[model samples]
Target: MAAKWQVVREMDANLIDTALVEAAYANPALRALFPLVSHGSLQFSRCTRFPWSQDLPSIFPYDGERHFRVRRLHEPRGSGREQIGGAVTADEAVELVASHLPPGCGPALDGTPDDLESLS
Candidate 1:
């Protein structure tokens, strides 16, 4: 089965940078499982594996409201990028991302008791 990944908490847009760093720090084990890259105003958190020639599953902030957006980065080809979903909260965003992640990525942070397993 593919591993699943989810956000541990709701990220505040006012402190997005701090939130991202704190989330990784709070979940050190899962931190290494998914790498986060920030470029200017854009941030990318990848949680899925992909073939050498394909793109991985990633999430970023959209609009000024900091709505969470998911997509696959095709890189140089840049032809396959598509918006997978959008949510008003980080937690919801992760739930949406979880549905598309490959098996074994980790666990879903859907504010459920099972979420605790991922942090353990």
Candidate 2:
């Protein structure tokens, strides 16, 4: 899981989309979650299929099936508090997202080559 994640971090949008599409085709859980990610949309949204007006950072719709909605949000600028359940906090939530950290992203949000190295 980490390997794929790291490799994709260094990729461009086209590559990322292709990689995600391939992964979704193979993994049902990923299939449901991958598409809803808006292209180049920095702002987070709930991972729900049904729209509900709420100020939540994002939502991940989960069903009994292996496939479900899952979103990964990034932390704020220079904030030690990591994102927990899409909210900034010291404690780790069930999940966290590395948002807007694609290739050519800002230094603060960019995925470093070291991140890939560490995973290796």
Best by lDDT: 1
Query: lDDT of each structure?
Result: 0.44, 0.31
Per residue, candidate 1 scores C-alpha lDDT tens digits across 1-120 of 012223322334454544543443344333434443444122223223331222344567676565667676556337777777765455555545555554554432333223333654
Candidate with the greatest TM-score versus the true structure: 1
Q: What residue runs in model 1 are displaced by over 4 Å at the alpha carbon?
A: 1-16, 20-32, 40-54, 73-78, 106-120
For each candidate in turn, the TM-score is: 0.46, 0.24
Q: Estimate candidate 2's alpha-carbon lDDT, on a 0 to 1 scale.
A: 0.31
Residue pairs in candidate 2 whose N, alpha carbon or C atoms collide under 3 angstroms: 29-67, 45-58, 46-58, 46-59, 47-59, 72-97, 73-97
lDDT digits (tens) for residues 22-115 of candidate 2: 4433432322231233342212222222341122233332332222233433342222322334332211111223332233322121233344
Against the correct fold, how does model 2 do in TM-score?
0.24
